[model samples]
Structures are given as structure tokens and as C-alpha cells.
Target: MIIVIDGLNRHRFGAVLDEMYRLRARVFGDRLGWDVDIRDGKEIDQFDHLDPAYVVGLDDEGHVVAAVRALQTTGPHMLADVFNAILDGEPPIRSATMWESTRFCVDTKRLGRGRDRHSVSYATCELMIGSLEFARRSGIRDIVTVIDPVMDRVLKRSDNAPYGYVGKTAPMGKVPALAALLDCTQERIGRVRDFAGIAHDVFLTEDAALDLFARGHTSVEIETAAHAASANNDTRPLSALERYFVEQMSAARTSDEVQAVIDLIDALPGTLTPEQKFALKQAPAALAREA
Candidate 1:
């Protein structure tokens, strides 16, 4: 299934986001030898902090297997900033109704080279469908993507080629890349759906996603328990809502992860300080806002 992670609700899907970053590292850095910064096994950059929406594909195990980042063209984006050379002297495309999709990749190591539903074909189409569907719903009229030649061919083979393109192909990092434009419409979504033979909804609710990560004792719970048990006896047990908040942070591996959980906690009525919440993985509240 697919999970949409945005700036507002990223905290709820911290682990899945981490998995997406790691997958990008594996695909672009380890396998494709792309020139990207890989620190601590994650290929993250300034754009990631720009509050772009992420369309992530998760396998049956709730691990991130595919993902694409979406950023509004009116502001800083990969092509406008990093790959401005690819424009070949043409003005960078910038508009409010147009969004930019980048960092498109799938987990080839786990899915292999097969063409079946479990393979890259299905996941790639699903990411396309998710992006189109999401953009259409968000009042976005078009999508501009910066992708390598390999991905361009994959799109054509899947019968979901870009509706149009911009500029000429240029050497981007280790691969030749270019800008392609896709319309955000039902027609595009239907084409990808038919090609992938996917008739079911591809999105999963947050709770369902968390449950699928593990049957019980989520990593957050495990971590919190380990620390709480060693704390002074005066500490009180967490409320039911508080426990749920912490459980969602099990996949977090950094201060950002901890802060994401803190953002959600801020929505819930609580007296928890940032320090207290970080120490115990206690969400500084409950899940109530939209992501």
C-alpha cells in the first residue's frame, strides 16, 4: 500500500520516512553511483527539510520500498536549484499550479527484476498513480519531474510516459537526466492503474500502517520500556494515548524523529515538556491533525 507523508503529519510516519531515505541511498549511491551526499546510510539534502510531500510505497511488511518527493515549483526545487544546468538556457519552469517530483526510485534488491505485482513494475506504477491522484486532489494542475534516463525508459515501458517535457537532456551527476511533465488528471491515473492491474485502494491509514510494522511491542514501546524501567520509581506510567504516541516513534533514529513525535504530541492536550517527551519518546499529544 501507499502512504502519503507531508510536513504536517510526518511525525506519525517517521520509520517509513527513514526507510525511504535509506532506500534512496541504496539505489542512487550504492547501486547507481549517483553523486549525492550519503551520511549515516541516508541520502537526505536541503530539499527534504523544505516540507515537500512524499508519496511512499510500502510492502506487506510495512517497510518503505518506493518513494517520490513532491515540491511546489513556485519555490526551491531540484531543477530550479541543483540541476539548473539541465535547463540548457531555457527559463526554469515555475508556477503555483505545478509541482516538482524528484528522487523517484524503488527497492530493486527486495523486489528483484520480475514483472509481476511484487516487482518494480507494479511499485513504479503505484508511485505514479499515487502522485497523480494526490496532485489532482490537491488542486495541482501539472507535475514536473527530474529523472534519470533509466527511469524515463521504465515509464515508457509501463505505458505511462510523460505527457510532455522541458529542456534537453543533460549530464546530471553520473547519469543523463531531464525534466518531464505529467498532467494531474484521472486519465493519467487510470492509465497507470490499468497497466499495473491494481483495482484496490493503495493507501493505508496511519494506525493500520503502525500495526503492520509489527504485531505487538513496537520499537518505540520497547525503547521506552528499557529506559523507563531503569528510571527512578517515582515516574508514573504513561496514559493510553501517551503510549500510542511513543509507539509511533519506534522507527525514529535521530533528533528529527524525536521532534516529529513531539509535533504530534503538541496537538494533544498535555503538560509534557520537550525534554520530558524526548527522554521517553512520549509524544508531547495525540494524533488529530491531518498530514
Candidate 2:
């Protein structure tokens, strides 16, 4: 299923974004040999800092199988900055009705590229359907993509070929890359759906998407998230224990009490998310003691 995440509200979907970034790191940095920034197993860049939208494809188990990022052309974007060499002196195509889509990738390491409905091809097409549908609703007329030749074939094979090219293909890392434009009309969306045999809605409601992730969330964690969201005035949501930890730490009169609270949070079951791990790492005394 496709779960759409607003860049500004990403903290609410931390696990989904975390999986997407890891998938991007693996696909672009390790597999494709792309020149990119990968830190702590996440492939992220300056564009992620901007309030761009993300169309994420999640498997039944809530893992990110595919993803595509969209940024407005009027603002700082990759085609105008990073992939300028592809333009070859032609002016950057910036339009209010057009957005730029980049980082289009699938979990090739997990889903082998087979023609079956359960393969990477389905995941790729699912991501495409989600992207175009999102663009259409947001009043975007088209999207320009910085993609390699492999993606070009994927688009064509899915019966959703780009209308035109912006510039000549140039070597981007290990693959030849260029800019191509795809319309965000229903016609394009329908073509992709017909090709992929997906007639149901691609976009999942926020509550529905969160429920899917909640399957992986422990009851303690979910209860924590709910209470945290209620008490915190800040836009960011905190887990239940995180809020309780803050409350206890605020009342503690001694450093040892704070260390004890840290140790308690670090003892939760299932698995520690990267955020939780980082939080535990910040408590030097607790970390050293645990080590």
C-alpha cells in the first residue's frame, strides 16, 4: 500500500521515513554507486530539509518497498542545483504547476525484479501511481524527473512514458541520467493502473496508514505515543515513555535519578528504534554503564 507522508509532519511517521532512507542508501549508494551522502545507514540530502512531500510504498509488514520524493520547481530543487550538468546550459525548467520527482527507487535487494504481481515491478508501479495521483490532487500539472536509463525503460514498459526530455543524458555516478517530464493527469494514472491491474485507491488515509504501522508498534509504545501527543504542545509527537521520562527527569533532584530513568527507558522490549537508541546514547552515564 501507498502511505503519503508530508515532509513537515514526518516525525509522526518516523519509522516509515527511517525505512525509506535506509532503502535509498542501499539502492543509490551501495547498489547504484551514486555520489550521495549516507550517514548512519540513511541516505539523505539537503532537499530533505525542505518541506517536500514523500510518496512511500509500504509492504504488508510496514516495510518501505519503494518511494519517490516531490519538490516544487519554484524553490530549491535538484534539477536546478545538483543535476544541472544534464541541462547542458539550457535554462532550468521551473514552473509553478510542475514539481520535480527524484529518488525514485525500489527495494531491489528484497524484492527481486520479476514480472509477477508480487515482485519489484509491482512495487515500482505502485509508487508511480501514488506519485502521480498525489500530484494531480495538489494541482500540479506535470513532474520532471532526474532518472537513469533503467527507470526510463520501467516507465515505458508500464505504459506511462514521459512526454519529452529536458536535456541530454549524462553520466550520473554509474548510470546515464537525464531529465524527463511526466504529466500528472488522470490519463497517465489510469494507464499505469491498467498496466499494473490495481483498480483500488492507492492513497491510504493517515489513520489507516498509522494503523498499519501500529501492527509493528508495541502496545506500550502506542499508548505512550497517544499520551505524548496529548500532552506535548510542540508539533513533534513523543512516545508515552518519552513523555514520562521527561516528566520524571524534570522532577529529579539528582543526576543519579536521571541516569536511573534513562536505564529504565533503555530496557523496553521488542527493539529500540534509531531515535530511541540515539536518546539512550545521549545519556553518557547510562551508556557507559550498559556497555
Candidate 3:
């Protein structure tokens, strides 16, 4: 029962807003002792509202749990605005088919407490797949993010490395931090796996990152370089028809609405190639089908 909501509308966005803040506070404030304000048990920053992001996750009853804030390079965001220092004056951040991944998290309590083994980890992977698919459909190919070194190591091992400079070690309360870029390709997408047995503390390192990259994952550097050169320039954004379909899907209020939107997307011309169409149509159904 994973849900993905588009836009920043209050209702959907608000659903997990508090949860996100609480998680961040627990991780950064309480666990790491960051200076984040926890007045109402929420950790929020000024940059949260600048981009169009997605929130994905499951509810308490064995549901998927996830959320992401996506922003393009055209807007005021980390890559172009805040994190420029890390990029070392690289090409002036301008327009590109790039999306930043932000505020991603999974519910800790629901992680390993059920019959489903690695439920939380698998849900996290599913959320990434769904979000990557959505980004591809929306015309984005590069993803930028600041991840925990351990998670960065896992991504590198998974072959999802980015093509840019790794940022200087910053103090995330007590833990270290690094920034990276990732190339979102079908090949890389296929290699995404569950974060099982990842050593939570010892995850980020050049060796670990390379191990992941050697497996076919590109580093953030590669993603950034490709983006800088516009290597995949010919990639197409979603057609107007596809956009309409997604809008309809996002607005769907019932199971019937969901099926109707899926059907309409399936029928749209050029929305997906034949093979991709089969995968897209079957994925959601394989996991949870109704109606």
C-alpha cells in the first residue's frame, strides 16, 4: 500500500510533513545532536517549499513508507544555489534535465517488525523505483542528493553513482556528510536492490562506492558530467498526453479512478514503448491490484 502524491498540495503533503520532521529531529537532533529546532517535534528548513516534490510511503498496516522532494536545476535549490560551494564553481548551474532528491526517509518502527522480511528496505527500494520511473516519464535524467556516507556507499555498490565531485566532509551533528550526483538510466534502475545487510555505520567510503560503481552504478560525478555535457539531450520529456495522464492519476480519489488513469496512460501514444509499457502496467498490479 505505497502511495505517491504529486505537487505540494496541503492535504497530501501535510500527511507526512509531521512524520518527516519527527524523523529528522530524531535522526539529526536527538540521535546526532544537531541544532535543529524541535519546538513542535518537527524539523523543517527554509528550502522545503521551493520545489515540486513527491511523497511516497506506506501506512501502519504493512504499507510502504517513503517521501522525496524533487527540484529541477532551473529553480533555486541546493545544486544551483546552496551547494554550489561543493561543486567548486563548476559550470554555472543552469537549465538541465536534473532533479534533486531531498528529505527521503523510511519509518524506523515499521522496518523489521513483520512477517515480510526487510519490509522497510524493500519499500525504500520500491519508492526509489517508482520515483525514478516518474522522473523519467517527467523528462528528468540526472539526480542530485546529499546522502549519509553509508547510504552513499550502498548506492555506489548498487551502481547508482553520480558524476560530480564528492563534497567535503561536513558535520551532520556528529556524522560526516558527502554530496553526489546520480545518472538515472534504465541500466542503473535495473540494479537497484534492497538495502539488506548494509553496515549502517561503515557504509560510505571510496572502496565501497567503487564496489557499487563497478557493478554498473555510475557515481554522482558521472551523472554531473553527463548533465554538464548534455549527453542524453535527445531524451524526451513526457508528452502532453502523458502529463495529463499523470495529473489524472494524481487526482484519482478511488480504486476505480486509479485503474482508469492507469488504463488511460496505457492507451496514450508514445507514453511508453511497448516493452516499457508492459513493465509499467504490470509493476503496480503485481504488488497490489484491486478492481
lDDT of 3 by residue, 24-143 (tens): 666657765755677688777656665466545544332324566677767677655655555554653455687777666666664775325356555566556656666776788878
CA shift of 28, model 2, Å: 0.5
| Each prediction's TM-score versus the true structure | 0.75, 0.75, 0.57
**By the TM-score metric, which is better: model 2 or model 3?**
2
lDDT of 2 by residue, 214-253 (tens): 4543333433443444433244555565656655544343
Candidate 1 per-residue lDDT, tens place, 1-291, comes to 787899988987776777789999998888778789999999999999999999998877666789999999888888988888888888888899999999999988788566676887888888888888889989999999998888888888877798888888988667888898888888778878888898888888876766675433355445455346433534666656555655666545456665776677676556655444555543312222223
| Candidate 1 colliding pairs | 220-250, 265-284, 265-285
Count of residue pairs whose backbone atoms collide, per candidate: 3, 1, 24
Q: Candidate 3 local accuracy as lDDT?
A: 0.53
Off by over 4 Å in 2: 113-117, 217-291
